[model samples]
Every structure is written in C-alpha cells, then in structure tokens.
Target: MSTFAKAGFKSANYNSFRPHYPPSFYKILTEYIGKEAGKTGDKVGKTIDLGCGTGVATYPLLQFSQNVVGLDLSPPMIETANSLKAAKLKELGIQDESRIEFGVCAVEDFDAPPNSYDLITAAECIHWFKDYPKFFEAAAKHLKPNGVLAYWFYVDPVVVNFEGPHNEKLLAIETMRRAQQIYLLYVYEDPKGLGVHWDRPGRDILRNLLREVDAQIPQDLFKDVKTQKYVPSVDGLLQLTPQDLRLVREKITLKDFTNYISTYSLFHNYSESTGAGAEFLEKMIQEFETELGWDREKTLLDLNWTSGYTFMRKSGE
Candidate 1:
C-alpha cells in the first residue's frame, strides 16, 4: 500500500478504485457510537479519521456524529471526496452535506486539542504510520474523555472448494489462483523499489497493541470474526466452449493467464514501472500458446480469505 503511494499512484488508484464498506457495517457503528453519546450526553460529537483516503470511513461516520473530519496526506483525494455528487452522497446516507469534512495532513503531524474528539477511526490506514505507539498516544490525546477508537479492514475471500482436478470449475479456480501468484511476485519484486510494505496486523497484534496502550473495550473485535467459506461461482466468468474445460488436464497458454492478471493492480503497476511488464505478459501468452509440449494453460490461483471485525466504546460522562 505504501509502495503504491510512494509511486504517486495512491490517489490515482484510490479515486477510481477501492471497494465501499457495506452500509450494514455503518449501521452497526451508529448503534455503538450512539451508546457512547447517551452516556456522555454528547448528542453528536466530533469524529476524526486518520489516513482517510477518499473518506471511505469518514462518509459513513456521519450517521453517528454531526461533525466528522477526514484527514489524509493526499490532497487530490480530499478534493475528489468533497465533490461527490448529491446522488453519491445519498448512497452514503449523507444528506446533511455539512457533516463530513476532509483535509490534507499526515496523522503524525497532527496535534489534537486536548479531549476535543469523541471518536476516532483509522480504517486500512494505520499500517502507513511511522510510529504507531506515538500515533495511538496522539489518538488518546484527541479523545474527548474516554472516547472510542475503532479499526476496521477487509480482504477478498479465498476459495478452497475449487481445488479438485481439471473441470470447468477447477479451471476457473486455477485461473484466479495463478493471477494472484503473479500479483504477489510482482509486488514482492519491489516494483517501485520502495522499502518494505508493512504487513497488516491480525488479531494477535491488535490484542498486543491494546494491551500495551492499556485500552479496553466491551466487545472483542475478533471474537465473532470467522472466515466465511468460499464457494466459487466459476460458471459465470468463463466463456470457453465445453471442449476447452471438458478434458482432464486440457492445455491452456500463458496468454490466457495474462488476460486475468491484467485485471489486477500489481499487473498495472508492473507495466508502468518495468516498461517490459506488457512484453513479459505477451511472452507468457506466447509460451502458453502451444498445447503439445507437456501441459498448457495451467492455472492455479491463491485464494485469500478476508474478514471484517470491529469493537467500539463510549466516552466517559
């Protein structure tokens, strides 16, 4: 993720790409924040989102607070977020229009007016912070007395059931897997030659951080979080004739796989950075064109499992 930003492609990709958090998730947040409001007598409090690219989390927080601030280092992202049309805002349930605000600033550089905020959220943005301990301490400073901090993230689910042999279904699963593998290779190769792209924390890290910071919550974010099984809807995408996927281990070529990899981010980035990324893809396509030598059009994808988890709290009265 940091590599993407370092490459000057953060906002470029963020504005057009990225998935929207489901409204169901926000409704749950509203309930939790409302609970805090009842105890503190703060009807609608100030909420801040750190590293809020395009305000994905900020726009959703509007239901829980009258004033929400989205701060990100990307100015272009801030601009794009502010100009979203009324229909777009309507989709986010942001009718008040003035409830949301976005700005260009790094979270570390921010100095909070003591106890001025009721809630703060860092959605998919915490990993980019340099000193996380200091960052959380700053978060603690901003809380309006016992204020809540929430973290939320998600990943695309992995598919396991598609693992048998070479049927149409198996072929589809294989295709997705191969694409993912190439993607991993592309990123791991240091496309932009940036420093390490920090790995995202899991439940264990979250627990350790909360403990180190002495932060407590009523609910365990991961207690109920479980990996939802992946059932491949492979029948939908492939337009190949019955003959293509019918035989056991029927051959396919590199060109076939490149088509799918092109749908991925790393492919695009690699194409831009390596200059030969497209040529490399073309080479793969040509290599796989022949079905005679050994096996062909072989695909295996890395099915990733992603989950969403959250825990919230209310500020002191």
Candidate 2:
C-alpha cells in the first residue's frame, strides 16, 4: 500500500488500466445482503468501502445503498476518486454528489459509531490489512446486527483462449501455456524480475485468494460466512458454470495486457529499482510475439483471472 502512496505512483493509470468487477458480482452481493437483512428487517443503507482505490468498487455500492463512503490510505488515490465523483455519478444516473464520499484513512484507523453501516466491503485490498482478527472485531463494531461484510479480489489473469487470424483456436492451448509461463517468469521465477520487488505476505496472501484472512474470521463476531473461489483448470481453460461469479474476464491485445501489468505495484518497484521498466515490458512483449508466433497488434487473447469472494454477517445476540 505504501507503494501506491509514493509521489511517483500514478493513480490515474491505476484507475484506467485496472479491471473492474462485473455487474453480476454485485447481484450476488445484493442477494447475500438481502438474505441476511430478511432476518433482522434491516434495509441496505450506508456502506463503507475500505481500501477503495479510485472508487472502483465504491461507486457501484450506491446501487444498493443511499450513502457510500470510500476510504483509502493514499491521498492521490482519494483525490482521483473525488475528481471522478461527478462524472461517475452522472454515468450511474445519480443526481446527488454527496450521496457518496471518498476519504483518506487506513481501514484500521477509520472510526464510526456502532451500527453505522449496513454493509462493509473491501475490494482487492484486505490482504494489505494487518491483524485479521482485530480487523473483523473492528468491522463487527461498525456493522449493525445482520449487516454484511464482504471482500473479493482477482489475481493475475491467465490466458485461457485465443482467436487466431483465421478466427481459429489453433495453438490456443500452447499459447495460453506460454503466456502464463512468461507471466510467471517475470512475476515470480526470474531472479531479476518483478518477483522479488513485491511487498511480501500481503501479495502472497492475495495470490492465495485471501484464504489466510478468511481463516482468521471470528465465529463469535460473524456468522453465515461463505467463501467462494473460481479455480481455473490447470489442464486448460476452466468451464465456468452458470452459477459462477464472473469476477474478471477480458479480450485484450498484447499492448492492452502489458498496460494492465504496468498497474501492478511490483512493476513500479521493479522499474524504480532496476531503472529498466520500459525495457522490461518491451522485452516481455517481444518474447510473447516471438515465441507464441502472434502479432502484438493482431492477436486477441481471452483472459480469465483466478478470483474469490467472502461474505459474512455480524452475529446476532
């Protein structure tokens, strides 16, 4: 998270290139909240989004709640979120700007009155939080009885399928394997790659889909906890069921793909440390084009991410 707070970090690029959560996921969230609300006769109301960078997961909350507060530790990220407030609200057909607010604060330090929020969410960020037991306790303090607390994240995208020049799935499996290998080499295997640059434990926890965090949840404070993870097949692309939550999917070119990589915190650290960020990306793209025998501009890759979500309700007395 400190990487994002750096003066050199570009929150705009992050907002632009990051993949957004699909609308279907929100429907799942609504149902989860509604199911719990049915017991307590509480309506979905104020929501607080922790680690809400640029309001990506924050704005959509307005669909269910009247007031949403997006909090992040990064000032620049908060600034960008606030800057886009008017435009995003307009796009969402929202009239009032004050319906949602963005603030700068760590999730641990954020304070609210007891029973202040109907829903509390952390999008792509709970891994960065310290002390999961403490966090759940604090979240319980803020949530009304039967209120929902949810968090979800998508890790590195895997190339599952490809459309060749003749619109064929030719070499799709091989290409997918190679693309993923390249991703791993740069992000994990290569000694000089971005692997070592990542902030430890947090990144590892997130890569594992927050299982570590989920395990730390206190049953005394929260119940009806549900954790779902979409695991892509190692043999090839996974066949997504109708019941699956579509967390991340995109048909993108090599350039588009690399741009998304640039948004990674490890990329920033690698660039700063090695002073070869541009060269690193260019070489990686060149390797993809050369080995996969695909044109950077012409090739279209269907990418899917290994993603998961956790939902829980505050335990009632």
Candidate 3:
C-alpha cells in the first residue's frame, strides 16, 4: 500500500489544513483557458485533475471546464473528495451533479480518450509519479491540440514577522526554524543508525519541489512553457501591509497549524512505523511554544508561504 493509503491518513484533516491556492492562482488558470477557448470559438471543455487529494485543486477547477475528473491512488482520499462534491458544488452555485467525478486510480492506469481534455492539472502531486516520461507522454496523449497542462508545488514556507513586538517576532521566527530543523532531523535523518530507509516520493517532492517537476516533464512534448511565482504580494497589487497580514494571521489557529503538520506523509509514515510520531510532534510543538513564549491556548501562527507553477501547451497548436 502507498504511504497515503496507510491507516490513520486523515483525509479530513488534510482537506482542512492544507494551504489553498490563492484566488489569483485560479484566476490565471481560468484566464489561460478562456484565451484558449476564444481561439477555438468554444467554451473550455473537459479537465482532469491528477492526484486530486480531497478535491483541493479539483473543486476550484470547476469554474473553468464543463466537467472535471479527480483521480488519486488512495481510496480514502477519493472517498473524502467525493463526500465533499455536493456541498462544494452547492456552495459554488453549481446545480449540475454531473460536473465533477472522483475516482480511485493512478494517473498512469486511468483510461481516457486521446485529445479529450482541454486542461490537465497536477497540483503538488506530480512529483510522486514513479515514471515521469511515461506520465508526460500520457498527459500529451490526453491533451487536445493547444490544450494546457499545468502543475505546481510549493517549497517550505517563508515566515515573516507580520505582528507582535519586533524582537518577539524575530525570536519566534527563529525558534520556529529551530523547531522545524529538529522535526526534520527526527523524520528524515536516520538517527540511532537504524538504517531506516526513507524513500517517500511526497517527502522528496517537498524537499526538491520544482526541480523534480522539471526533471519529470519532457520538454520536447510541450510548447510555450511558462511559469509564475506566487507570493504574499504579486506585482505589488496583492501586497499585504502589516495590518492586512495581521488579518491573515487571525484566520489560523494553533490547532489548524498542528493539523496541517499532521497531514504530512512523513509524519503518517513515521507514526505508523515507530508509533512515536505524535510524541515527536508534541515535543516539537512544546519546544516551539517555549522558545517563542507562545501560549498554546491563544497563540496563532502567521505562516507566510509562497508557491509557483509551470505550464505549457501541447505541441502542434
């Protein structure tokens, strides 16, 4: 079984705590699709969101395509995705039930007609594919002429001192970094010389991010390759002033932060293997709280994260 399929994988927590792609990210995708639609004199057609865990990227995609298919290898992940479809659709004012579908299948094995999709997306999950060239070939096979293929992953967050006293914020950020290093050592380092083999694709992707994406996608098969970096401010229009940043901080709680950390595949795997994941996490959290002088009951962490994407059009447009 895959690490994502391991018992205790909390799909709900993953959905709740995972960082969402900003609205601007979705806007850019829709604008690209709209421009392509204009060239064809037809609205955007079908889409497939590869590795659409808990429908994070899949749900946002509904606005751009007539239908979307979210595919993942883990049954529980698919189940959680399907469970949210109706509510999300309703929330989005979508009346059609046929607009979205979730399936338990790896992208390699999922069947689709050639030239069927107008857009294909694999957000934060493409790095897990065992065969990049094969996956790219499959993607090309499924994309229509001029179709768009977009995928992206985020590196570690860029924490900023958005609030609190200047000295306290600096101290907190430093302590957070130290806590992270300790957690990484416990999870990734084979401490105690136990020869623990840590070969998780998700973990590798987290460490390498876009480098893995570049290594996987065949450059010859696509055209008009492009990329965009998403930060707290894009083009200075979305800049978060100190006050705005404070508002952003208010949305997250300590529980939300911990829940997000728990969703990492490394934590799940570590927990399953050694039964010490929770203890390790608790110790790390305590250390961070102590170092930052944060009250666990009231402190909210301000996580300043950045992300980016690379996209290309199918050749022969």
Candidate 4:
C-alpha cells in the first residue's frame, strides 16, 4: 500500500475510468425521495456528497435534487471528482454543469449550519470516517425534517452473468474483496487512516457504527444494501493485464498464471507476516489458475462481481 502520504486508486485512473453506480441504484434513491416529497408536499432540499470520490455518486444526486455539495479528505480525489461528468451525459448530449461543489475537507471538521440540507449521500467513503456518531449527528442536524442520509457504492466489470469457469468467478470475487479492503484501513496513508476494515475488520467496525445509526435510521429511509457488486478484479490485479470484453473466454489458475503476486498490494502489506501470508496467496492464485484452465494468453484477465447495496433512511417520524 502507498504510504499515508500517498493516495490509492481512489485518485488513480481506475476511479477515472471505472464504472459509476448503476442508474437503478440512483433510481431507487430517487424513488424513495419522491415518496417522501409526495407525503411531505415538499421536494428534497439541498444534498451533500460526503467523501464523494470523483463525484461518482454526485451525478446520481441530480435525480433527487440539483443543489449538492461533495466533501472529501483528499484534495486530489475531490479534484478528479469535481471535473468528472456522468458518462451518460455525454452520450445523451446533455450537460448539467455545476450541480456539485467539490471541497477538500473531512466531514468531521466541515462545520456547515445545522438543518441546512435535505439529503446527505456518502458513497464508498463513509466507512473510512473515524467518528460515525459525530458524522451522523452532524448529518442529522444538517438534514431538515424528512431529510435522507444515504451512502452507497457500485462495482465495475459487471461479472455476474459469466459462465466461463468457477475459478474465474472465485478469483474475481476474492480479488475484488481484497482490493476493496483497502478502504477499511491501510487504504489511506498509514498515519492518515485505514479502512473501516473491508470485510471482517471493517465489518466489526460497521457493526458498532450501525448500532449508533440504527436509532437515526428513518423507518423508510435506512437501507443497507450490502450486495452492490461494484469492485472488479483489476486487469493487473495479479499483475495480469485487463482483457478486452469477450463473452465466453478461457481460464487458468495461479500455476499457469503470472508469478508476480507482488503486483497485489494486499499481499505486499503482509510482507512481515512470517511469509505465511505470501505463501497462502501464492497457493490460492495458483489453485485458481489450475482450476480455470482458460489461460489463453496467460496475461489477460477478466474480473467478475455480484453487486448490491447497503442503504438507510430515517424512519418516517
């Protein structure tokens, strides 16, 4: 992992080119908001995108409201996000410029006025927050009555519908899991912060955070859809280059694949782990290569995923 001073793929090309959250994902949020607006007879007010990495979630916020503010701890990430536009915007020749304002400040320190916002959306970055209670408190205070606080994410390389081989799916899922783990901790610079803990490590932390958030969850608003499949195996995940989208491809395990598991920073983080971790990853990669038997170029790799979401809204009060 890069030092605390270094940023991860959060500011890298992957973020620039990777898939944005599915339209349906935003559709779901908008539907929820519309329902709220209908009952309250008022549209959702201004929104804030906390940790809006490249504003991937910001574009979707347009579906519910036009006024949105995106906050992030990394200036570079925010810069990248602020300049990025929804892919569909270009495709449809429709440009909604200035719907989001990108700022470099941790939400913990961002002192916006209370009850100022109608919706707050924190995508993949919420888990990295150090103080969930403070964040929610501030978010709740900023949100007006019936305001919605939403954090969600999506994966790329949409790999669920493939039927190539079991190993392909296994490797893709494991690779995605490990890479996404970067946010839990060690994702940011060492001193800067770590992830909430991707699965286990992060899960324990999320479990505790959820306990506090449970009370604030709007009965119809809180939705933790953990099943968003947004992370794909990087073309270079195992040091394997990305493959062109070809339906019905071949496969292979680690033995037949690259010897450079060094390409994986997840393993690099464990260099001090008595060499056991390295050996284990090597074995796992090799086993995957062997089982797949589809090593066409032995250099090209495909990533798959089973995507879902975790969401929460304030219960109707």
Candidate closest to the true structure, highest lDDT: 2
Residue range with the least summed lDDT across 10 consecutive positions in model 2? 34-43
Q: Which lDDT tens digits does candidate 3 get at residues 144-246?
A: 9889999877644433433332226555546555545544554456463112534556556656646776765676788877766545431123454321111
Candidate 1: worst 10 consecutive residues by lDDT?
242-251
Lowest lDDT 10-residue stretch of candidate 4? 240-249
- Candidate 3's C-alpha runs over 4 A off are 35-43, 162-198, 229-251
Q: Rank the candidates by TM-score, best first.
A: 2, 3, 1, 4
Which ranges in model 2 have alpha carbons more than 4 Å from their true place? 35-43, 165-170, 234-237
lDDT of 1 by residue, 1-317 (tens): 33333434445446443445655555555555555322324446788888787776677666557688888776666776677636557885556767677787887789868888887888755545666557656766677755777666543323232332233433554555554444344434444421122243432343233232234332222122111112223332422231111111112233333454453344545566676665766554443333212122353322222333344443345
C-alpha local distance difference test of each model: 0.51, 0.84, 0.69, 0.49
Q: What overall lDDT, based on C-alpha atoms, would model 2 receive against the true structure?
A: 0.84
Give per-residue CA lDDT, model 2, range 1-317, as digits (tens): 68887778889999988888877788788888773322333437789999998999998888878789999998989999999988999888878888899889998788999999989999999989987888999999999999899999888888876665421343566667777899999888899888999998899999887889988999899999988888775344477655455755456787888888998989989999989999999988888877777777778877777888999999986
Please state the error at residue 215 of candidate 2 in Å.
0.7
Q: Would you list the rank order by lDDT, best first? A: 2, 3, 1, 4
TM-score of 3: 0.83
